[model samples]
Target chain A: MELRINGLKKYYRTGKEKEVKAVDGVSLEIGKGELVSVNGPSGCGKTTLLLISGGLMNPDHGEVFLGEKNLYRISPDVRDRERVTKVGFVFQQFYLVPYINILENVLIPTIGLNSYSASVEQRARDLIDHFNLSDRIDHKPGELSTGERQRVALARALINRPSVLFADEPTGNLDDYNAEVVLKYISEFAADGGAVLLVTHDKRISRQAHRSVRMKDGRFVGDDTNPVK
Target chain B: MSLINKPGKRISIWMIIKNELVYKKFGFITGVLSLVIATSGFVGAMILLRGDTLATEQLFMEKERELRAEMLQLEDDYRIIMRNMGYNVLILNETQSISELEKEGYASTYLDYEDVWKIAESGMTTLNHLLPVLQEKIYWPEKGMEILLSGIRGQVPVYSKPAHLTDDDQYRSPIMERVPEGKADLGSEVAVPLNLRPGDIFTIRGEEFEVNRVYSRRGTRDDLSVWIPLDKAQSILNRPGKINGILALECVCSTEELGQVAREVKEVLPHAQVFEFSSLIAARADVRQRAAKLHEEILQAEMAHQMELRREKERLASVLIILLITGASVWIFVLILNNVRERKHEIGILRAIGFSRLKVLQIFLGKSALMGVVAGIIGCMTGALAGVLWSGTGLSFSGQGSLVTPPVIITGLILAPLLALTAGLLPSVLAANQDPADIIGER
Candidate 1:
């Protein structure tokens, strides 16, 4: 398994006696070359599950394993290092730094990894070319269209060649055409032996995944294999 | 559009700060402006203080020089008054009786006329202006009167005395004029009784003489006397190359006592005794000391006034500097805090992509430091220039370069950045500690 979660539970205090079960006793496993999608409506805890699994948020009771290394068992600094080197995250907002160009934006992950070399830069350029963003590499995020920004975000995610990719609503802000393009890139990442855990409410996106999991009230209701279209 | 422009360069924290500053022009510029105002105020105050000290020192020297000139003039006036009063010391034969000298108004005992030369050549510093005089009361048969006749010549110069430029004989003599070989100067009482004038012929005990000038009336013993050539009087009195007294003026010094003058004179003239008119010497010394005391009081008063003014200026500048620094610190704090608030999502995204908390802190802190560095340079130049102009020192770099010394400039340079860093610390820490999950929400 490229990424695994065992008995994960997270809660939020709503009042003195009331709490919301954001993720409760959830368990899932993803192998290399497999793209799994969590389908849920708004406020259904799918995003929370993704956040806990990506080593960004701590679960109250659970273990998150990236290639047999428990993220929660290690120190925060080590966990951060593990996440930067082995896990990549993509969000719906495409939170790009407005002042820097798209090429620098894609190379930002390499800065965290402290691994920028001629080869790393060459790979970034290749990723830009693959995402069809070579023409827009030098343009700031404000100047780029919605589709171009999402593509830039996707390229940034794949730049470090992480073992697992966690994307939350990566296509929520894009048009149908751009969403299809972004989803295609994500599928390609998994095809190249990467593990992908995508969380979204769009059922149509779930059909494109190798397996789909339906979540409600912080629990998985059904897990099924989706037919390849 | 230019892919080749950014290929070999790494994206550093400083580079990020630079780009961010360019993007947020208003915030960075306003921050820099506030820092410049504070730093310039500090630099200006320092320069102004230095200039004031220099000006005060120069003014003090000028005033002291003027006072010295005035003191010298006062001393010359006192010398003239004392000279008119007569010599303060009388060196006579050691065997002369004090009672006989007082009763006859002349020394009964006599000393060699060459004895006066011995004192002058002794290089003694205590006395100057030696005049050898011979006097006696005699009945004149031709004039049909009794008179005290005195013989005198030009004063003897003492080589050891420092030359008083005012006492130069080329300008004017400091004592009575010498009587010529065939002339005489009669006292007012004698001249009135004898009906003599400047060119009148007179006879003194069978010796004929022409009256040179009639002396003005003095209420002292000199009014009843007649001055004539020393050789003529010596011949008439049958006292050749002999003198009853040596009249000399004692040099007045603050440390010189009346007894000291007598002792110094007797050391050179062992055969002669010194008689210093104590009242006359005391009065001259008192006048000089009083003048010196007045000069000292005036100089001290001027210095105290200047110091008071400097203290007032220092107080005002200090208050102004404190206010400026406070205002700048508050402004920087607010600007950086607002910047952190506005860039929340950017920080979140950077953290989510694996940037550490320290890197985020470097981004904000680096921006603040850049602002301070640039402002420090501008503030130093403009502050020094403004200080010079405002103080009316004139903009001459050669005269005023030391006012803006290296230490002052270095402090200004270091102060601005340190202030910026100190003021921006809290906001930068807050930005660094921001949780990526809370900012970039899972939803």
Candidate 2:
């Protein structure tokens, strides 16, 4: 499904009768098999855009269309269903469940769902194996290195087979090698027909994307495609 | 290809809770111990209070029972006395008026007591005490000790054999209806100083009475004394039913009742004296009154002692309750507050990575609940053991284990977890509802 956004806006109250527009009238589109990167400085609404698109925060005014359905037009419960089954997110800090093995951390999206069976277990094992963590499947997050934890978090984000993936500074805490490895997975996920949106201050991350958008002061400043880094 | 199961999620939640509890040993121990100690105090106080209450109640009941039995025994004794005295014995004292008798709990009884007569002196005979026949002599000293015998009359019947009768002598003839009519059914072996037969007569004080029947010898006082017909004694002694004094078997009654009777008798017979025939009855009543008064004082002391115990229990309970709430609440509140503060970034990451706010709340609540379970078990056991150890049993040293009963333990088990949950609530909710963008900065 192609993800479409139109006229997105959000605001915050700094004091009585005083307000700041965090995200104001922003718009973008990403097709299946397309990975889009949004780059901006601090308070430039890059994170706010991603949050609204991922249904993590409600926008004051916006229409987000995932395929033929308008995400914001639906009930919050239905939005949650969409958020869980159709969207996956990655954060800069690997939010690994501190007590659990890597495989169990990857299975968090299935919470509150009664649809558990043998195949789900095997699928978790397979995903952990795919991440080159088969030997460390039972190792708690505390015992893992930074790179391993990021790998576990990536595996967790993709465990539910979301149609769109949102990443907010996914490699912000990583060294160059680990960062490249994380970007490569995002690129590979786009190549596998899942739409991708990556918000970051790091220009290096946005430089190599199929499309790049630049934002400033709650508005998009530049939109470029097919450009050489 | 990837899939996840619900149980897999539950296991994940369980691991998160277990992880913090095991890794952060100091926090877990501090939290648990706070709850345990407070719970133990509450449970222990309640156990002791309950035990004391039961023991005091039991003692009070026993004392009451003993008092009731004593009162009933007095009542039974009074009933028996009434039974023995024929329930209707009468006495006459001519000196008193009817209005005076009415002042007691009885009316003035107009009935008169029949007399048993005595003679002052007689010549020509020494009466044999063993002689069963009553003797009355009617003669004048100027007439040379001669007796004029009255003709035979109808016999008056009585049931009590004279106490003076010897074991071998039984009354074969009907005795007089009046009390202590000195005559008896004399035993045959009795000796008489006078020559007398069943038809013989005797006189005294210028009046005469006949010996209706001569009886067998009675080796007792009956053999030595003489008895005369009641009417003959009245005329010869110059006294009738208005005799100066008479002995009676009274209605066996309570001291209060007997006092009332004596007052009534005094009202009717102002110069007459009435009292317990045996000295022991009055003395026993006095003893009982003193004993009852002493028992009452003892009971009042016990009541005061019981009141003190109750006040102490209330005081201890209030203190324990405050201690319990403060300790448990402070422990959970500070522990969770610190934990949530430390884990803000983790919470942000979870929200960004697809875990819900509810899931975050569950993780922390589960940690506190685990603490509650341990506190419950430890608190209950310690409290129960303390209760048992404190109370001593029958001889005042070891109890029948009236210490921590079921309610105390139940309250501990139920209340411990609840306190922990309440303590953890605000911090946990704050942590759970934390925004991912705020702490982890756009995660």
> Cα lDDT of all candidates, in order?
0.86, 0.67
Per-candidate clashes, comma-separated: 0, 31
Report lDDT (Cα) of residue B198, candidate 2.
Answer: 62
What is the alpha-carbon lDDT of model 2 when measured against the actual structure? Answer: 0.67
lDDT of candidate 1 vs native? 0.86
How many angstroms is residue A194 displaced in model 2 relative to the true structure, after the best TM-score fit?
0.5
TM-score of each: 0.92, 0.71
lDDT of 2 by residue, B204-319 (tens): 45455455555456554344333455455455544454233233334333355455545555554454444333344454456667777887898889889888979987897888
| Candidate 1 docking classification | medium
lDDT string, candidate 2, A150-215, tens digits:
888888888877889998888889999988888888888888998999998999987668888888
Q: Candidate 1 chain B: minimum summed lDDT over ten consecutive residues — where?
A: B164-173
